[model samples]
Target: MKQVLISLLLIIALHTTAQQKTENVIVITLDGFRWQEVFGGADSILINHDKFTEDKKGLQEKFWAATTDERRKKLLPFFWNTIAQQGQLYGNRWHNNFVNNANPYWFSYPGYNEIFTGIPDTAVNSNDKRWNKNENVLEFINKQKGFENKVVAFTSWDVFPWILHEERSKVYVNSAFERIGFQSPTFNLLNEMQMTAPRFLGDGVRPDLLTFYIAKEYLKTYKPRVLYIGFDETDDFAHGGKYDMYLHSAYMVDQLIADLWGWLQIDPHYKNKTTILITTDHGRGDAKKEQWTSHGAKIPDAGQIWMAVMGPDTEAKGELKTKGQLYQKQIASTIASFLGFTFKSAKTVAEPVSDMLSK
Candidate 1:
């Protein structure tokens, strides 16, 4: 009996150790998403602004509210109702969660570089499509013992292939209209829909919904240990000054996240063993109409952004209303920490937000 009890304890300890050593990680990015809409909901100030949308009465009726709490819930019900209840939300400037970009350039390439590489580079100045020179944390993780060939990136933006250095990194990358062939009916349906759906941008970019579906299919099929999803409809609409489409895009993406979370809870592989981080490449402007439409060196406060983390491994802190700064660059290391990997990047910029761990 004594020997049996000892063996049982050993088995339990081994299982727990394995669980802690290999946590699945999902990193999601909403391109150029603003922090304003995240916490305060639809900007009551910009909802009906003439530059953003001419349908003033329609906009007011749809998103208007008496308070910030009410408006945010209406705009992003999943974030407010689900994620906030289970995880942590940062970069609510009003609440003192000082989350913002670390790079000087408030654009996609530089911002994404900081996020993946954990370093800010002045050379990464423009949005020109080119392979990044810096090695991202994804590549580093892929080189690790247990994570080799386990990393997958699915992006709606065409530039992601270059941004993450897919060629150099040797990480599996499917961007824009790139879809893997699957015998499943779901994949077939999504591919057919993409064929009929209107192309929102150039370079074979399809609707974000299509991207979401493709990623979902890939998730169930491959079941990668590390997955990165890049959704661009929110930024695309914002750049086009289509406030209605932007709002819809944000809300729909939130639904995708909720659905994924629900599915994860049922999947034995991901249930209670995955850590997901939702954030943006960069932040849009909040000051003026033009700035709101554009993000760059000229726009003040364009570096401000937000991030949310939820999983069994993370603490149930909800929103970080406390006062402190968070850099987008730290995300890579944070992910590494959750997956039982250390970045050890020579071009390191910052340490992981250690409080992010609870597992």
Candidate 2:
């Protein structure tokens, strides 16, 4: 009788441990967005510097606040008001809670590879259009039971198809100005608009706003279980030395995310069953304010990054103030863990972030 009772209790505990509440996961990336802005909001020096801000008065009116908390809320209301209230935010250097890229090359390709592959291969050191051989967690999830044909990625950057190796992975990737193949009315309208949209960044990249709309429409149409949205305007504007535009893009992206989250809560398929994980590919330099426009192996501080997660499976710890270090490589596994899978690859993958998971 004693042995049977112990056996029954063990089975019940195992069953409970295997169960998860998150049935869907959405991963969002803001390319090269800095932790400084994410945590401290608009920099007093940069906001007013003649070299950086073309309309100091206007930017001040928009993002300026007396305190860091107020400034951050002004800049990213969704993050500060929603995620910070109901999620876990990491990588506030002010609080000594650090999140850094494991990859040595602190640029786009390597940073993204580290994020999705769970391994920061030294060879992935360029932003060129080269096919990635690493198996990313997205493809891994797509191959899982019930997730087949339910994983998709929409990116503002043209190189994401190569970064994700859509050819080999078979993950649906719609990037840059590529027209959506779907024939729905929404997709058709988006396709027509994209064809005529100004390529302000260049011919190779579409605006982040377009990318957000495309991804949002895809979600409404197909309801992919795993979705990735990569926004590129922040990085592009910063590189062009347009500080005002960079901040504006950041604020716009925050609003877009808030809109998506609000929609998710109302949809029966996604309500209370979806997890949203947000982070940046890499950080920009801060020691020299000018270096804020760039990120690479040369800039040591560019390796610093940040992450935020809110969902049924994540704890609502808000902004983490405790001192702890996390790596970008852990993101792939952390994403998979939400859906009750351990992401594995040919190379050893970093373990999931235990702190973010529910107890």
Number of the predicted model whose TM-score against the real structure is largest:
2
**For model 1, how does the per-residue alpha-carbon lDDT over 212-241 read when each residue is reduced to its tens digit?**
888888899878889999999888888888
Instruction: Give the clashing pairs for model 1.
Output: none
Best by lDDT: 2
| RMSD for each of the candidates | 4.7, 1.9
Point out where model 1 deviates above 4 Å: 1-22, 181-183, 287-289
TM-score to true structure, per model? 0.91, 0.96
- Superposed Cα deviation of residue 269, candidate 2 (Å): 0.3
lDDT of 1: 0.84
In model 2, which regions exceed 4 Å deviation?
A: 1-14, 17-19
lDDT of 2 at 127: 89
For all candidates, what are the clash counts? 0, 0
